[model samples]
Target: MSTKQRIAIVTGANKGVGLAAVRQLALKYPTSPLNTGGSLLIYLAARSPERGEEAVQTLLDDAQLREAGVLVQQGGSVTVKFRELDIGSAESVAALGEFLKKEHESGVDVVINNAGIALKGFDSAIVRETIRTNYHGTLDVCTTLLPLLKPSPQSRLVNVASISGMLDAYSPAIQANFHAAVNKGSIPAVTALMEKFQHSVDADRVEEAGFVKRAYGVSKAGVIAFSKVLAEQQRQDGVVVNACCPGYVATSMTEHMDRPGAITPDEGARTLVMLALQDLDGKRGEFWREEKVVEW
Candidate 1:
């Protein structure tokens, strides 16, 4: 790889918003304000190898991508590769980290934690599974990849949070705990809160214990909180950490419901692409939606 080449990874990118973000990143990164005439390398990571490879082929065959000057061919300024990554699996996440470390000596420039699960029902098992994949799994990926992040203004870590994760959805006491955990800038503190939420769910006292009964909501809340704490911890390293709400998109996660106003996958991915490639003027930790920072 050229010294000027930039590398990025987008997890759970087989379809929907994740795939759209990968396409947009490849299209925009070359001419981005942060770019200075370098090749852009993006790893479209998905849990299924077959699906991941298919997504890469789809992008390569896209007429719009070709017309827009994004060439997946050899000697192109942009290259998209498929890497199997199951964020929910520690071994899978570790394998990706090791591959990057070995293949790209320059290190990784961007990481988008888009791999998450939202079950259909609410129960102790459902909540456990949701938190396991959304919160703990994401944290595992971050921890495993932290060493590979190149300390630069362009380096970014974007966590795919949701409006459902907004702190206002929780009770005041739960909100207070989140606030304190973020203030402490400690991963353990935030994790403890997530465990407490799970315990509440197990005991069938989520609302009474100051937490929302929605499993997805609580998991996303943990993601937002984790992003804040991570941002504070990585401030000195110049890695921008941010969480974003992609809006109500008509993706598989929400396909069961009829949302009239839900945006397209491309539209939902705009903010994510922006965060990955645009210069944020030194903004460190923030919750973003539609390219603007909003309260969580």
Candidate 2:
């Protein structure tokens, strides 16, 4: 590794916004404000190694064509390593921790928690799976990887949340619990809240609790809360964490929608891409929309 090398990892990066984040991140590192001239050691993680490698190759080809010779050369051959990571699985999350320990002695620099699912149909099975992957899965990844995210300035974690995760979407009581838990730095309370939401789903009474009826939105709300809580816990370590809306993106998740105004995958990835490269400037536990902090 070069003296200016940065280790970055992006989950669910095989396609859509996740893939775009990985691509733009490769370009961002060479010119990142946090580490000017830094070469990116990007882990383009996916649940399937085959898909991840394919995305890596596609980005590599794009870089060569788009920058001619400037990008890879200036960045000292920006490397993309693929890892099979199923964030929904605790065993898989543990495997990622071990892999990082083996790969980078200095530890990770950037993490984009982009691997999440959206369930439009609220089957009992579907809602649990949604919470498992979006809320608990994200929570597990952050907790497991915090120790590996170098305890220094300029380190970042970008959770790809949605505007739908807006706190107001929850009832005032649930919001109070979330804020109090985060303020107190109690991750267990956060976990319990997420489980409570799951139980609401089981009871088919999410609306009664003052939450969005959709499991996808509810799950994302959990992710947003977890981001804030983890940010508080990691603040002293100089690690900046943010939860940001990726915007209404035209991916498989939204392909079924008969609506207009959907942005391309690349456009949707802008907030997340920018978040990974920001200086943070003493900010933590922020919610962002298009790179600007929002009141969510």
**Which candidate number has the best TM-score?**
1
lDDT digits (tens) for residues 1-296 of candidate 2: 55467888999999999999887876666667766665667889899988888987787678443673324634454677789999988999999999898878788899999999986687668878888899889988988888999887688998988888777767899889888877887878877887787788788888897666677777787788888888878878988898999889888888635467778888889899888886767778888887789987
Q: What is the TM-score of each candidate against the true structure?
A: 0.97, 0.93
lDDT, candidate 1, 114-180, per-residue tens: 9898789899888889999999999999988877999987888999999999888778988999999
The residue pairs that clash in candidate 2, if any, are none
lDDT for 245 in candidate 2 is 93
lDDT of each: 0.89, 0.82
Please give the range of 10 consecutive residues that has the lowest summed lDDT in model 2. 68-77
Query: Which stretches of model 2 miss by more than 4 angstroms?
Result: 1-3, 63-65, 68-76, 256-258
